[model samples]
Target: LSPSTGHRSIRTSSKPRPAKPCDPKSPCCRRSLTIDLDQSNNALDFVIYPRQFDIGECIGSCDTSGSSLQYTQAKNDQQKNKPHAAYNLVFLHHHGRNNNSLAATRNHRADKESSRCCSFSRTGGLELTYTTTVNGPIIKKYIPNMTVESCRCGLPATIQQV
Candidate 1:
């Protein structure tokens, strides 16, 4: 496929686009990146099927301050009545309960060692037909974790290894 056929450029007017309202529930999410294997500048010799394909990527902020998309119902419920700063357990424990009396206590202590990032929580594979040379035979290969299946806000070190 030619460069133009592999990727298309969008023509826009001078007018600016209206700003989209910020969504409180929107946190780190997946967006697609178009891969053009047959592009003129692409030096890949493999003849990938579907010359142009979209491989999803993670985008957006990792700040979960007002975002519910990354949290579960149980987590949200815990946030409603948070624990005391000094105590590792909840206030109810002082009365007559155990540490587990409330939801699991979070280590609110900021991790200075590493910062959170928008990363892939899950990953999939892409099966494409490729050839060693221009006239070589087509071979189907499943590249492990070649595609982004899902995304989440987490430490870069905690990203799942394919």
Candidate 2:
């Protein structure tokens, strides 16, 4: 969230990271962000920020798609916004990756512009590919009693204490 006005995916022309051993399939684990959302109604509003703490490194630095981590970063090397590791999609999970049910959700402050979903709850979380660094304003549509599942590297799996 740098440049003061960063609300979308920003691309940069930086160099690629050199070949390193840390460069494996980047076999990462499942990292989840648990939020204390108490919506008495039937649904709740959710906001997922990129990185909430100093993940140090290797958090998103590896890939299993047979692709190497970018030599250069898409965003500035400011820890949170760093795109050394591609930011994957955030999935709206139910209990523990089962089917779904329930409401809708949205990213950022644009709630009115969000759409609705039925049957199951699955929202496309903030995904920053190698090309794009950070793209806020994601239309996260999910019901209540849900969580986020993202493919990430480093530290097995770290639950982001939101």
Candidate 3:
């Protein structure tokens, strides 16, 4: 991926050989910025409160508010100001700055291009970390998966899972 842009995500690269095969001058080995948000949880990697999402999985999942919310900046915000979009998931950030709600609303209107994305889920759930010989569709397993059920089985009559 380009350091300035998070595009060109390699799901899986060649297996680590005894020697480095990449040439710095080639586009394949171009400079890349590895954003390790989940690992380091750095501030720059997160969106400041003034530019946070109002209601979404990214912020609410943290279950924080106020000064606590300040500390709860979303790592997903980094993607917001980018000139390009991520391969699969796109994160839209809500403006949380101190200003009139009406103005803020207009500025960050949903119809705005910047507001468009896959979702506000900070995790984006792109498991771009797996290292193996596998690549492409096979690397999809890295992304987080969720299971849902409408009702419980073999339980009391009134008991329901959903």
Candidate 4:
């Protein structure tokens, strides 16, 4: 009878489990932006030319000479007297894992504030491209036309993206 008890134990097998659910707040499940820079097969020299005069109220200035630089007209009459130029500006933000962290949340707010203020005070123009992702599925893509204007007043009169 003891031997029968040992041999009569029940055994059952279960199907393999499915993949674990993705966390809504997980950084691993988030989307990211990819930037690709294509330079022709040529060795290029790089240089940053400083502004000879104050470039409105903004901290940066137009790169006077470069392969990737350009100039747009001032948005207003007051800005026409200043030197006009354009350059690529790269903004890098490092947000840690916590979605509620200050860097993650406040970066866009700060950029909005700066853009509003600079639009009012600056004479020169700038165009930027970058990527950001949030939990929401909403995606926004903006490609502004080449702007040429006097920066004193009014938005870019000739705003058209090409």
| TM-score of every model versus the real structure | 0.50, 0.21, 0.16, 0.17
lDDT of 2 by residue, 69-146 (tens): 231231124245433222322222222244223432233133221211111112122322221124544542322212
lDDT of 3 by residue, 67-118 (tens): 3332234224533533232321121222322334776567655424332222
TM-score: the better of candidates 1 and 3:
1
Best by lDDT: 1
lDDT ranking, high to low: 1, 2, 3, 4
Candidate 3 ranges with C-alpha deviation above 4 Å: 1-33, 36-100, 106-114, 119-162
Put down candidate 4 lDDT per residue, 1-162, tens digits, no spaces: 248566533212111112233344331111111121232122211111111112122212222231211123222321442232222111101111224666646765643322221122112222233233334333333323212212222211222212
Best by TM-score: 1
Model 1: residues with Cα > 4 Å off, grouped in runs: 1-24, 64-114, 157-162
Error (Å) of candidate 4 at residue 153 is 9.0
For model 4, state the Cα shift of residue 152 in Å. Answer: 8.3
lDDT of each structure?
Answer: 0.47, 0.28, 0.26, 0.24
Cα deviation at 138, candidate 2, in Å, is 25
| Per-prediction CA RMSD (Å) | 17.7, 20.5, 20.3, 25.0
- Clash pairs for candidate 3: none
RMSD of 3: 20.3
Model 1 poorest ten-residue lDDT run? 84-93
What is the clash count for each candidate, in the order shown? 0, 11, 0, 10
